[model samples]
Target: MKQRGIWPDEFTFAPLLKACANLEDLEMGQGVHKHVLALGFGRFGSIRIGIVELYSGCGRMMEAKKVFDEMPHRDVILWNLMVKGYSQSGNVDMGLGLFRQMGERTVVSWNLMISLLAQNGREKEALALFHEMRNGEFEPDEATVVTVLPVCAQLGELDLGRWIHSYAKSKGLYPNLVSVGNALVDFFGKSGDLETAITIFNDMPRKNVVSWNAAISNCAFNGKGELGVQLFDEMLDEGVRPNDSTYVGAFACCAHAGLVQRGGDLFDSMIANHDIEPTIEHYGCMVDLLGRGGCLKEAHKLVETMTMEPNAAIWGALVSACRTHGEMELAEYALKELIKLESWNSGNYVLLSNIYADRGKWEDVEKVRVLMSGNSIKKAPGQSTIV
Candidate 1:
């Protein structure tokens, strides 16, 4: 309060800076930095850490690094913040470098590194880091198990996931916390072991929306759409409030099962009965459901009436449906919209070109080829794996 001749102290500025970071108010953060300097608190370690955290939280990695570099002495917490900042800002290389440079690291450091790698699609590297952590005498905690289990699910490394499961059980960590149980359910579901997922779901001491949504999504994704719909009803009957993700999963099941009327009913019920507004994803599922049942006109009408602009995925789905039904004209319309939304995505170009080639439209095919060449869009090689 400059008017009152009072200035905030380091303790006051610390939290104020944190608030600015959370709000992503870079200008206010800079003003607070000046206040810290004016109060002669610039050399304070806690305040410096607060500044680094502020910059990092605002996605200002360079500014965060500058604050970190100016610190004469750094502690474990500072190192953790820097590592987390780089990792979250998509500088995984810098994150890993800082992680390796630490002379001494706490379990939090290890967990952060593993989780960061896993989330960035480096499941293999995440697993290797977990093994390295074990060899370094750091005991795996509940947080570590929760972090690495998803990596196992993504890579379909069921064996590694099982090992983590066994470790969790022996450590008396399984089914106690919903987070760990949710991860186990997702892992089992992704690994094509629905039985185990169901068992874990049944045995959990307490079930949350995430637990139910994970099981429901697993069913929908694994080709058991009818089962997924059944579970959706069960979840609602048991008085669990369905979230957007739950609705998405249920809609996906309906689409896959060709339950057009049922999908429409659920879409209406989501807003009228449940008071949950349908999102773009829900609309996309409706389009797929109608298109799959040879109701392309209805799907097109739904798209035209969508509250939000249809994204590339929805248009891509419609294009795919048109191709399946041999409706070249409709496919061309959807393909044009998809290309406009994602010009760099070569898959859209390739799909449109193939549809034209299939229908003996040589001129259209040649046009697509020439466009691809001009854009330097090379088709990615197709790869398949048998599980």
Candidate 2:
């Protein structure tokens, strides 16, 4: 078109800009921005929205802000995009600020803000916002219900989750939407109410991979490893394709139950039949399983054979195994690898020192203490927050 002495319109630029954003080609995005400016298209709302999205996608928040500030009129969609960009980039406060600045908000705006806060571990603030939203006469939608339910589950706020469930039921929103039902399943699963999770799952008119993964993984996480294993079998029997997460959940179950041979078999089957390449988490689970069974050498070899470099968790598992089995030399080796990887967690130092102390190696214990003190490393105190 340029060769023909013709210019592309906003419709032409929007898709091109979106392509640039998807590719993260900052230079191309800038070129598009320049073209938009040269064509005097900045005043067009649709073009401006695309520009904002392009800049935000390229991580040029300042540029996006410039576009936002110059917009003579804005809509909820524009506000939603800006808030989403901030939240996605870990600037939750900025996202909330943008939301508060808006004179009006849609359900999308409210859900985005609430979900962002809840997903990012600001459960207390999320709950407060939910309550405030209700007080202001904003009825919670399916998205809002789904978003905050997991927060309640994670914080073990079963009562809050139950209240949300009740509200969702009263609003005639339960068991219909897969998303809402899935969230409820996850919430109950995380709260150690496997029976309730199962009931919800069974009652769901539809089930997705997320619903199954959540229920199974929660069982493993909550120390019902045997039951989790059983569920894994049932999931397979039902022909629900297990993904990498499912394998991890099953491996975790085997690890917790000290089912070494079974764990190894399942690990092999994951590669053979499931065709899901084992990730670092899966490798870590195997190490934990073998280590707990006094198969330190096997665990060490497994780490060595891993396709990717073993992370701190894998080494930590070996170190823990060594400590459990009184394999001081192996523990020392694992500790050295951990330290080499720059894993500065004070607990690692403490664990190694305790191992030495257990073996009556006073000199080694003293050395570890000296190193920890020299580095000013202190163990973090365990604290629990109700809200």
Candidate 3:
């Protein structure tokens, strides 16, 4: 267009900015913003909103805010853009402050705020906002239900999650909306309502890999490890390609059931069959499975030969296995790696101390205690709940 002498205007600027956002080309987006200013389109509300959207989409919150602050007049869409930018950038305080400053809000505003709060680990506040949204004039939409359901999942708020399920049903939202359906499965799974989770998963008109993962994970969560493995087989038979998370759930199921051979096969096939590389989590699961099955030597070998540098989790799994199987030497080796990765972890010291005590090595146990005292590391107190 520049070569053809067709200069850009405000009408052209919005789409150009949107294209930049879609492509996530921040440099090109900023160049377009400069052109907008030079072309006198800076004063246009739509152009300004587009600029804000471009910056926010690129995770450039400060730049987005500068564009937003300079806007002479702002609309609900602009406010939503700013809130989304801050929320997504993990600036929940700024997001909430901007939200409270809005004189008027659309449903998108409420949903964005709730989603932000829920995503940032403020489940209680997110739930409270949901109540406020319910009493307001606007009705919660599919997006609202999808966003809030995860809060219930995280908090294990079974009752609240059930209510959301009913609401989704009443609104005819589920089955048609795959995301809401998936969220329902996840919520029920996390809340220990495995039966309901499986029911929801089976009832969904459509199922994705996530849906399969949720159902399989719920089986593992309920300690029905074999059942979880079966579900994984069913998922593969149904032709849903598994991702890394899918394997995580599957390996966990095998670990819980002490299905060493099955776990080994699954781990080996991750790269061969699925073209998915085994992550540290997968390697850790294999170690735990081997350790629990009394394959301590194999577990240690697996850890030693892991392609990636063994992290705390991988070493911790081997350490745990060593303790369980009475392999003090391997346990010590694993403990050494654990200390290197997480010297500050009191659990590691405690585990090592317990291992030595189990073998009647009071001197080693005393040394472990002395080390703990010298490092000033204390075991975190345990907590329990009674129903």
TM-score for each of the candidates:
0.88, 0.88, 0.89
Local distance difference test values of all predictions, in order: 0.88, 0.84, 0.86
Output the lDDT of residue 236, model 2: 87
TM-score of 2: 0.88
Counting clashing residue pairs in each candidate, in order, gives: 0, 0, 0
As for candidate 3, its clashing pairs are none
The worst-scoring run of ten residues by lDDT in candidate 3 lies at: 378-387
- For candidate 2, give the lDDT of residue 1: 78
Model 3, 28-89: lDDT tens digits are: 99999888878788888888888999999899998998988887888999899888888888
Question: Taking the tens digit of each residue's C-alpha lDDT, what string does model 2 give over 1-387?
Answer: 789988688688878777887898989889988998898777777788888888887667888888898888888888888998888788999999999999988777888888889878898998888888888888889999988988887778889899988887788788878888888888888887878888888888777778778877878777888888888888889898989988888888887877789899999999999888989999999999999999999999999999999998889889888888988899988987897676467767776676677778888888887887788876557621111
**Model 2 Cα shift for residue 45 (angstroms):** 1.0
Q: What is the lDDT of residue 1 in candidate 3?
A: 89
**Candidate with the greatest TM-score versus the true structure:** 3
Which residue segments of model 1 deviate by more than 4 Å?
Answer: 1-5, 339-387
Best-to-worst TM-score order: 3, 2, 1
